[model samples]
Target: MTRYYRALRLQMQPCGISNHAAAWVTTSRLRLTLPTSTSTPPRLQACRNSRSISSIALNRTNPPESASTRSKDGRQQQNGTCAIRPANREFSTPSKVGRIYDPKMAKLWADTPMSLISETGYKERSDIPPGHFAITAAQNMAHLHNVIIRGFNASYNQCLAVKPDTVDASDFLFYNQGLYKSIKSHHDVEEDITFPSLVKLTGVQDIMDKNIQEHKDFDHGLELFRTFVFETDPKSYDGKKLQEIMDIMFPILHTHLVGEIGTLLDLAKYDSKKLEEWWADTSKKARGDLDVFQDAPLMLGCIDSTFRLDGDPRPFPPIPAPIKYLSKYVLEWRYSGRWRFNPCDTFGKPRPLAFPNPGGSKL
Candidate 1:
């Protein structure tokens, strides 16, 4: 699959096809059938006629016909809207109102208004029943790391979408800086405070050794990524090069980010009280010295409060109401241009990408 994806990417280079089209081509082939009479496969056909494939991809972004409207029969289908109807109503008759809930048909968000952050394909750490300390702590870490993942992907995709000659480089420069600072700060806190605290709490010297080594795996790539963006003058800024750096770093970074959550979940075997103490200390240290203007915007811009997991929407980062208000109203103004590439609004509402690739999914 990886080799085929790579081959598709190579084919895309000359065609100037967007990532969405490539993904569509790749995934569609699994279920799609073509005329055996055709000499060229549809995958190659798309590359040969880019505009047709682009149009097909763009059409997918149109609002899907409502679930009720998609029934094959002429009968009106009962959907979420039918729940509010009177129980005695003819249309609300239980026998005729069977609703088959398919996880495959479900959406992560109730309303998808934009090009969503690419899914990492890693299943989220499940919520512990009644919530263990491990689950609580891991949830916090997962949310924080989620911000990094989405922020990085949003920045990466936008860089790919826009030509260097067209957009101002400063926006990307500052945007990259925000992504760099947030990710770097996260790892630094883990290594300096969180990991040591874990060892002390568990009395197991290498309790967090694996996670630390995982951090090291991507540290150099992340540093190089950071240095490249910060050091490269905006006059010579290359979005493509920035993307290349991200391409190398993000996979390793993503693996660590996702794997570490499982590590925290494994800590459920430890005493809850001690884990809680460690969490209080580490979480405090993590939030320490936060630059409201810089950090808060990135968090708000990346989080989608509407994203539903375990049948519930996730609230934003647990901060004071005043802090949330101040960050949304005032601090966000500082890097307002950079946030144009952000996947969400100040209130964590998903919004259309400011620079979506041509024919990309706008959901």
Candidate 2:
């Protein structure tokens, strides 16, 4: 049967004409036989003259009276409406509803004016201590925290649209590694270098203990993130599952950063030397431990988890107090060349801090 079919196909081919011309002849024959009552004679003539065999074949395959052609004609039948077919196989039409603005809502905030609060009322009255170096260090650490947080938030939110499974495996690995290194190094520096140096500079040993405990809390959150990355399939991330992980970790991170900032502020008030020592140690650790490649993965994991509330999309909460402090601190460190010491005067304009005063002012 196959042999007979092949012979019949060979016999169907034109004797001297090429396959292209044969196809044109076959299509033209088909076009001549199509019913002419439905379409205008001009369209039929135009189809006959179109040189491309494929065009004629298409016209014959989707005859003018077919459902699809009728649908297209129906759309054209509508006055002043353009039928747009998308590449994704969806059809769309222009909206007729005009934009409506709520005047009451618009007017509510329109009459209210904004003004910068005066710095005069909020100045710290403490005398500048002789060991200016320590004061600067505390300020620098504050800055570093700010930068890291901002980088984390920006990178994380950018990746939300990325399917967890679809994320580059290399990037995921890098992000996790960077996160571990950054957290571990920060903890190590506080325990071994920053805390000890602060003790020597300020003669206050209790502060060091408190800082160590804070580091331990942060380490707990880091441990949770590490476990999630290792256990969860990146590609199959369930929003709820990711959110559960985030809920457990963000508060810990927030608390740890806020505690550190509060401690630094206290140090700044008393012994600037200790603050300077702490900043130097932390910077040294951060530079050595943080891996840029790993940041993205860590951030993705963190954000995916944090933003997963009730498995529904919601506005990301305001930047945590610790992150804000860290951002400001890092910005200062970048702008000012001093890695170990940042003078209070350099914190020129009063800015928001995680720690708010009784009167609602940021410390």
Candidate 3:
């Protein structure tokens, strides 16, 4: 074994992940096959017959694409990393194979016509870290996903509900950047802060690996979605084309959005005080990561539109009073030409809903 192999072994053993195959699985790029039972950690093993330095497993770099994966038209899809699955896995869901393309169905069920349900008996509970914080984070992330999806829907409906024609490229660009930065920025911080903190506290290194993989599974989709918006000329922009890309991207994104809540709630067994402390610290990191000019307006606006200060037990980080004023009036105005496409108002209230959510009357 080379010195690098010995170093790798020394680094991982103390992390509680170097027991066997689990160690190899955590450090390597192999797809994890987690057991149905949560109690048992997955088994893995590493071999150290290093003929060369490159032969040793290292932190994964984005893998290269294969010739066999080209579209029949002889062009590569913008992000060629996503592999489509054949209809064969016994345990896989429909989304595992490919998207079920039915705009009507998606709108009908998931994004139903808005019928205002009052907070008649909604009781907010106090949950300590791990579970409480986890659920809250999941809920907020899901809310952000909903806001983005609805914004896209509204933009599409405005331009092409009845027919497709010229779209406002400026609007599309703004929306694309807003949505992209919002989701990506949130995720980057969580990966940087929460996952590592949780691991340190619990001494279970692989606990958050599943969530990391979920983020990975959707990367190509986001890339394709972004590329389609940026690369296509506004004059040539087709609503159907946008719909198609969204259909390709959203199923995986949606699953990740909601799936993470349950995964995090499972961590309640850990130390609550430490988890809570970590949540606050991680939140600061997330807030600090937000760029005042580019990302602040979209993120703050979306949060304002989705999360309620009055009802939500945990208030999201507040924009300091001075920055809040400047961002709301000056900075947001600079970049928010496309907020007309947003489903909710800057304050998080429903502004007549949007395209996907049938604009229903209030009681």
Candidate 4:
């Protein structure tokens, strides 16, 4: 009698993954084993995809129950809706965005609306859940890409402007530095504060390992972009080099941002009360470590530019009203030269486009 041995495999593409890595602890590794005659090949074919956005390995051992996060009745609750249902484990964003290489065109944002993961009724609900927050966060992350892309397009246009010499490269470099640091702060918060809390709250082991791996995947390009920004003299800014880096970095970022959001539905398992508490605590602590005076101006500049009233998809993190007034009125004037390229005023209101729109359309 002949016997078969089936194996699982994980394949990573040769290009686009990053070089400099944060601490990546691989809890599991894919095995390539010989299969028996009875084993079918279809199973393997079903698993392969570009995004690597599959759900956590469900086969892992689930711990014994601690308490009923559920109501007296066993049904789950989600986003103020009663009798919550299990997320269809197989649910995935309909498109395979990882296959695309350009962030500007990937259209991943089109697929990751907050409503897809949480109850749509939350839009009307006076209160929203953590899962809802994650969905909005995902939308905001995708929007950040557009801000970066717009900045790049503006630079490209400047290079082609009727009189290129009249344009100052140093001023642009200051703008780029501010933009880069803002994104860096956002990601730093995720890796340091948010992911760990989610892992504990969700009660899923190694749940965030893949997210960390994805960070490692794109962080190399980001590091290169950073070096260029800080090392290159603003007086002799290299627009060509800047464009080249943006093209390389955007697609990798798109894949990670959209893919990470797709998994947030899993957080819906925790009760809304628990979810809200975790987010509130985690968010408050996330940025507490940064130097406020030196760092916040640039970060606020970038965040404010991409996200503004009625036009933006989500609200800004709850900054106190007094601080908002001070940041806009008191602190931002120091950086006025660099901020001239920004799409908003110091108070986070939309401003006229500083660079000419090549397609001659509204931003």
Candidate 5:
């Protein structure tokens, strides 16, 4: 019985469907042998589901077509991958181009728009010294410094003229910021280019070096003033604070201007070749450190005359005022053709004019 049951189980194992429909035997009497491939015909195994059966038949008969479809689907999936998307890629080209094309200058002169102040004739030319180019550069530096100084003085006076309590804090801050920005920018250009070049040209490295140091000192004072204006309470206009700010600022400015003027006058004697060489060397060293020179006006208006009014009465008369007045009058007379002879010339020995005080104050 056991042997018969084992044989029945072997017969039921998945082999195939037979063509004969009535080849059955009772389980108690059955005996079966597995068919060898050479002796048995090929058969179809039964699938559990219709879809799986269809897929199996299709795969067997059309392998190349199915493989082609799979390859196409794979390619689309790869293309849709987030890592391959356009938006995911970094924009490196613009930055690279920018670095390549951008001008590496501290200031550009051409970008500064210039307007003609007058259409009249220029001032008379003077004989330049051997190192005239260096001297000219120094003069330009001095002129620019004076221009900024005058601008600061004017701005400060304007601020002072207004009643502090009535003035808008925002307006005052804005004004101070503008003045500071302008002055600081100008000074930076000088320290980075103008003064350094002048030093090289004149070969007065020591003086130039000292000037650079002075710039640091000047900046220190400026920082303090900036802090006082911006960081401190706007309503705090105590006498001590005001005095402190003035005390730190005025002396530094006065000394800087005086020293710069002296240096400029000394530089005026250098030759063109020396100046050119100095410029070349300094420019090479500076590389793109300097900003592009914007042709902004050195000054907006004339300097204040009030600073000169601060001293004791002198024994000698003030010479510059009369000279300035006479010079203008003489030029006007010449232009108008109202003079009979050369008003500038004299027949007697030229003696200094005794300028009598019109106001009878006993001196």
Candidate 6:
């Protein structure tokens, strides 16, 4: 075992992943103590290493296709079907094809016919009059919810698109886990941090009472859906059963997601300064605490970089360019295969679905 680990470390080093970083990912679940280093913190080191290894793993695993498999548009053709192009093909270029927000992908991006939450008629921060923060908060809330909804629909539609026999269950399940974890993590923060903070901030003890109850409305069904996806063996996976479970809960969940936007908008009645403080603090906590391995990638992969807001492109999330670049080039490689199911690419541009509906189902 010692010799094998040494060999693994040697191989990983060429990819620019340090020995300590490799250990962090391979034994992530296990607690380990190492001599403290001044260079980088443990968590950051883990993230950097995971990114390097993921890209190396992807490149090593997916070999170049033969000239015969190349299509006129430069995508690979396999068994007469257009195969998902390699992640590296358009690594430095924005995709000119595939639009996640298009009418064809309505189920993924739209809450109602022709209505996208990202482009919804919410007042901008600058447009708000002095001290009025409700509309800004609501827009931010809507943006976050829209991403989550897109991820859920992406996973749901992918399951529906491919035949069960042909689907890669591991990739599907991991992607589902990312979506599941993202939603659960966000709600957990709300229940544990945001809700209580809001009650104190507004002096309305039950400001989020309806939302809390609504969370209960679909909690069991969501749990069942999560269990069905993760616990079920790949060979025994039943697509129909998965759809049935989602059908029972997702409508209720979607209603809650949309309704929460209204809830934020209604905060106009509260003190604007207090509301702004709550949003600022809570948003920081939420962003800082995301699971870098899963939730971060899931969120980044759902955003639409080209989807402008108030004529400003890439305005959502409000992350800096350096972090965004790291996220796209490095962190995203952590779940490179799982992200294949996401509606948008790592940089948030819409791309062709890795798994498309075989019968051309209008779902």
Evaluated with TM-score, which candidate comes out highest? 6
Ranking by TM-score: 6, 1, 3, 4, 2, 5
lDDT of each residue in 16-117, candidate 1, tens digit only: 123443454345333223233413356654543563345456552322357555434432232221111111111211111111122332122212221222
What is the Å distance of residue 309 in model 3 from its true position? 11
Every model: Cα RMSD to truth: 19.4, 26.4, 22.4, 26.5, 42.1, 10.7
Name the TM-score of candidate 3.
0.55
- Candidate 4 residues 1-363, lDDT tens each? 011100000000010111111001012232334333322246533432211223124232322444444434453322211112222122122223211123333122212211111122223434445455554544444444444444444343332221223334566666666556655766777777778888888878788788788878878888888887788775566565665776677667656655665455445545756766776566445442232333445444434322332233343433333344444443454554455555434434333344433443211
TM-score of 6: 0.68
Cα error of candidate 6 at position 7, Å: 35
Q: Evaluate all candidate structures by whole-model CA lDDT and list the values in order.
A: 0.57, 0.35, 0.45, 0.44, 0.35, 0.60
Task: List clashing residue pairs in candidate 3.
Answer: 20-44, 21-44, 21-45, 22-44, 304-348, 305-348
lDDT for each residue of candidate 5 in 156-204, tens digit (9 for 90 to 100): 3233322344324334443444445555655665676666666655566
Q: Which ten residues in a row are the worst by lDDT in model 6?
A: 91-100
Q: Per model, how many backbone clashes are there?
A: 2, 22, 6, 2, 14, 0
Q: Which 10-residue window of candidate 3 scores lowest in summed lDDT?
A: 44-53
List where candidate 2 sits over 4 angstroms from the true fold: 1-122, 125-131, 155-160, 168-173, 268-363
lDDT of 3 by residue, 217-285 (tens): 889877877787677666666656765666676667666655665565665666656666766555434
Model 4: runs farther than 4 Å from truth?
A: 1-167, 287-295, 303-314, 318-322, 357-363
lDDT by residue (tens digit), candidate 2, 92-128: 2211111112332212110001110111111252544
Predicted candidate 6 versus true structure: per-residue lDDT over 123-166, tens digit per residue:
54344454478877766666677677778767666675544544
Better model by TM-score: candidate 2 vs candidate 5: 2
Residue 139, candidate 6: alpha-carbon lDDT: 65
Q: What does the lDDT read for residue 174 in candidate 4?
A: 60
